[model samples]
Target: MSMVINKQLPLPVLLKEEYPLPPWAAQAKVRRDEEIRKIFTGESDKFIVLIGPCSADNEDAVCDYVSRLAKLGEQLSQRLMLIPRIYTNKPRTTGEGYKGMLHQPEPDKAPDLLAGITAIRKMHIRAIVETGLTAADEMLYPENRSYLDDLLSYEAVGARSVEDQQHRLTASSLDIPVGMKNPTSGDFSVMLNSVTAAQHPHNFIYRGNDVTTSGNPLAHVILRGGVDKYGACMPNYHYEDLVRLLEMYEKRPLENPAAIIDVNHSNSNKQHKEQIRIVSEVLHSRNYNPKLKKLIKGVMVESYLEEGCQTIGGEHIYGKSITDPCLGWEDTQRLLYKIAENC
Candidate 1:
């Protein structure tokens, strides 16, 4: 009863037509999707590191960061799959702040949905064609998935959005692996239940039309740590925490019972530097237990060309995060190599 219609944007189909992905890039995406899906399905031993800027605010910087990842991906192709996190959609918990490139293509500029849509599409397409990479994005807005679905190899349901019905249903319809993160409450059952919902067939209203999905067997869990009632970070990436997840998975019928540990977020208590230690420990846990290794496929790292974050509307620092702080490039490269060696 209290809303303003700012503009009637074009549908996803029209947007796709306006900015089409090249045939070669589309083919590349197909192969990348298959390869990444295998990792989630337990068919590949390769580990995935979804690393990049916290929010893809600048096209040139994000692409430059991903270009470096493409080289690293080739260097460790056999053991690691470096999927850059070109996240255009961001969830603002308090309903304010920089919501990501999808809200404003430029961080300091006014929100322009039309230009933002164009910017995100162009950036994603460039990553595929120029760098030979298919990136991951957060499904912050379930209704907007179709806009860039063809370009994404992996998608994630944020801890805040995991419990939403639309997000669960959207994950069910997606063809690529969709990560359902444990909620802020850190309830294992909530995350597992969302995965179950996403792995089952459903007929639902999507984009104002009735749609039926065959269901996505690659729906899995992401442990990003959680927040307690008193607002303290509670980690669950320890060996015992993973063992609990394994036992829970054993009792569920969820397909592709996999978990990706988010190295930043609550897991690191937002200390960007702690990502290195978290990754090392998780990798060690996998080595200690073979079964745990299979269930824990990979990790998500928030990193960029520069270390840490800067406030939006202030003087911009190229390749640094404007949202959450991220690990810097030098540290990221060294740590990635360390992970590959251990893997």
Candidate 2:
């Protein structure tokens, strides 16, 4: 083997026992999960917003940002459903760069997988106990899902991992909603196939056990735009794009048959400020077409305590992102209120 054997780490059950959730937090998670489920099942008319930093690099800053969002959720209770994004693991295109909190809890520190696991679990627990919000996370490593499975109410199968067999199978076994994004090459068929695979029964080898999953009905699509053959960003958040997705959904046996528009990524061309404008355009499209309003459940926004991104390995800004550029809290709050009024 090319890799060195490391010490065995604590399993998910042991870790949960070590840092168990409080009674209030456990009850809150149940309520949040049910509300989110209603949104996917077409029983709720309120819009959903998955908003937070691109990478949760700091414990204090992430909790602070989500605490503010939890308050906003209270203010916009009737119009929208807010699920903070506490992404602990990040996907690197070349297997380099800071791999988020799961690889390095501290941006300037060296990689420590053991400490990273504890830090991520503690972060999620704090977000729920203090703020009463059950956040979302990306399934970067399928086997690592169990670590935060109880703390998270939403999950995302990133564009790069949505087509992977393990990701699809793992998502099938998950009880939470999993948003499968279109591939980097902009292939809708690949995204659709992933959703189908996730929504059907599967028998696979997982954690050295032969497991059978009853399938996840909440498996759905997320339109985060895509990259073209020329390496340019191509957007699919327009009215025509959504209309095409509805057509595709009609042809499939998917359960929920809904999608979420990721306002960042290639859709905004990494232009963080463009997120607000893109959201406005999409909302306008939804209003113009009644069909679109039913099909698009919500949007995903990348925002933080500060605006833009900074390079790692220095005394960087406290709340700015170490990965991708994100909107500041002021802009995020403004956009949320605007969305609430419109919704």
| Residue-by-residue lDDT tens digits, candidate 2, 1-343 | 7998687988889999998999888888998899999999999999999999999999999999999999989999999999999999999999989998988987788999989999999999998988899999999999998889889999999999988999999999988899999999888999999999999989999988999999999999999999998999999999889999999999987898899999999999999999999999989999888988998899999999999999997677888999899999999999999999886
lDDT of 1 by residue, 199-241 (tens): 9989999999999988899999999999999999999999999
Error of 2 at 307 (Å): 0.5
lDDT of each: 0.91, 0.94
Off by over 4 Å in 2: none
The pairs that clash in candidate 1 are: none
**Whole-model lDDT for model 1 versus the true structure?**
0.91
Model 2: how far residue 141 lies from native, Å: 0.3
Query: What value does the lDDT take at residue 253 in candidate 1?
Result: 78
Q: Give the TM-scores of the predictions, in the order they appear.
A: 0.98, 0.99
